[model samples]
Target: MTADRARGALAVLQDADGKFLCEVPCGYIVEPTASAYHIRRERARAQRRRRAMLRRRVALTVALLTVAALLAALMPWSGSGAADKPKDTTAGTLEEVHQPTAVLLPSSGTVAGYVPNAAEVEALAKLIYGEAGIVPSTTEQAAVVWCVLNRVDDPRFPDTVLEVIEAPYQFSGYDPEYPVKEEFAILAADVLTRYRAERDGEENVGRVLPAEYCFFTGDGRRNHFTTEWKSTDCFGWTLESQYTD
Candidate 1:
């Protein structure tokens, strides 16, 4: 039966109408015994009554103990749910005990390392091509150039562009699959020489053919210079948009 219905039945048994029967059939219990049948019957009935009383007492005791246990388990043994979570009281408190107190610095450097020298730039360009094993396009070259410049200028990376490119653990340099190409090495040397000459105002010194910030391809065409750079109305060409993917 359901617990509720069983409890209802137990309640009925506790009523005055449910008082002990004061007697039980004894003959059935004493058929094999060699004694006064009526006396034996009386004793058996009394024993049955005693057993019923014990059973009821045990059940009541168990129910009471269970209720007590449940109450104990649910008491505010701790505090509220919020209290259970370690209160970050130290968050607003100036107390030193509560603070994490640990400080961190960039593993790379305060500013990205120096601009790549001619040899270093050549090594990096060749290394990347060797690792990627892909023919270097003007746009890809432009990307590396910009990444190097930005890295050198920014303190978040290695001190120099070449060092930033060669940052440890990020790129596996000696992997057989990533073979540095000879063409990249040649181009690296060429580009570095040209950049040096241009910086020195040696050739095409005054002409503004390409903006310095020109870094990527936007119109599905790589290394294509825009006519807007030639406009006299534009005193200076902004290379900022060159890195569009």
Candidate 2:
């Protein structure tokens, strides 16, 4: 061979363009060029960017999941139909006295069911505040409410709460001008809530009196509830058996 052929034979590590040819373990010879190096560097940069973007997406997803979990933990959970039921705020009052377990009775007569409204609640609160005394027990307040509800339930009396209270000589404490007390308002709301729920067939509703014992007579200090009139009655008005449920 000539001098150039001998030099070419000796240059086994280089290609025809004088680029170095590297022998890989898989038996392939690779000639790395500047253009190829630039392309590989760009591809590596793109892979790093893709990996960073994936990590950011994963972090964002985890953060969202954590926030959702916290929100769920903070939210109040209730049973079916209990969400709409009025919650009682008489924990302090109940702690003062042992609250009697409510007597559940199937509602009867003309005014069996009721949906407590603002006007009716306000009226009942005023009457309860007046009749239940200045510092009456929770039971006494509830008793007065039940008495009014009982009269409404009886066919002989008016079917509505306002009518029953305004039924001339029926409720002596009832006055439209009376500024309702907060405690009485709370008690009235509680009793009416239970009454509404009981009318809707909800169980475990608390009540101070049964459907039969309607009449009540208070002597400032305390009130007395009975099925029939006592001989030593405060209000000398004699009611017949037809007046009761």
Candidate 3:
């Protein structure tokens, strides 16, 4: 074999048919057959193809994960802000809106359930003031007003506010000509307005006293509202239990 000096020290020697015979790298000889050379070349090509396929799979997985993260960020379960606001179901509309517990009354005199006349407001306010005005708690005063309202709503008691207040020893504190406090009057108006709004389904105004709590008595310190009769000296009694007896 003649050494080709033009090539580098690491050179490949081939036969007359142009097939690889051996490689001489820094005087180290490695003799390989033509079939082995072809087999190694094919193995290198296969390795390149496998690397390309693995890179493609990694890129596809990353893209899928990014899309999933974006979808999760847009969901309402992530927070309690605008995305979590309840949909307004009023009048068959599905629009999302801010729902308040108690909405302010409109400027119009008439509301959905009942109109607020001067006499009804004044009579209810007088009863509230006389019964709970002596105490400092506005909650107590509102409870008194709610008690009267509960009676008005109950079928066993008078339907109208004035009738319920004047129903023969039901509310001893109520007098037609008694001076009513201004705060009590305003409170009465607010309660009535909320009641009207609730009837129209405009707001979710919860009652201070449940509908069953229709009896109450006071000893000049605090008013005790109950769902049942307490004693014969109590001012109010449940008409449901009385009729059942």
TM-score of each: 0.29, 0.47, 0.47
Q: Report the lDDT tens digits of candidate 2 across residue range 11-63.
A: 23444455556433322324333465567779999999999999999999999
Worst 10 residues of 2 by lDDT: 77-86
Clashing pairs in 2: none
lDDT string, candidate 3, 115-227, tens digits: 56667777776676556656556666677777777778888778988888877535666656555555667667767776676667774463466666677766555677766
- Candidate 2: which stretches are off by over 4 Å? 1-115, 231-245
Candidate 1's C-alpha lDDT? 0.38
Task: Please list the residue runs of candidate 1 whose C-alpha ends up more than 4 Å from where it truly belongs after superposition.
Answer: 1-122, 130-136, 168-178, 201-245
User: Against the unseen true structure, what C-alpha lDDT does each candidate score?
Assistant: 0.38, 0.57, 0.59
Backbone Cα, N, C clashes tallied per candidate: 14, 0, 0
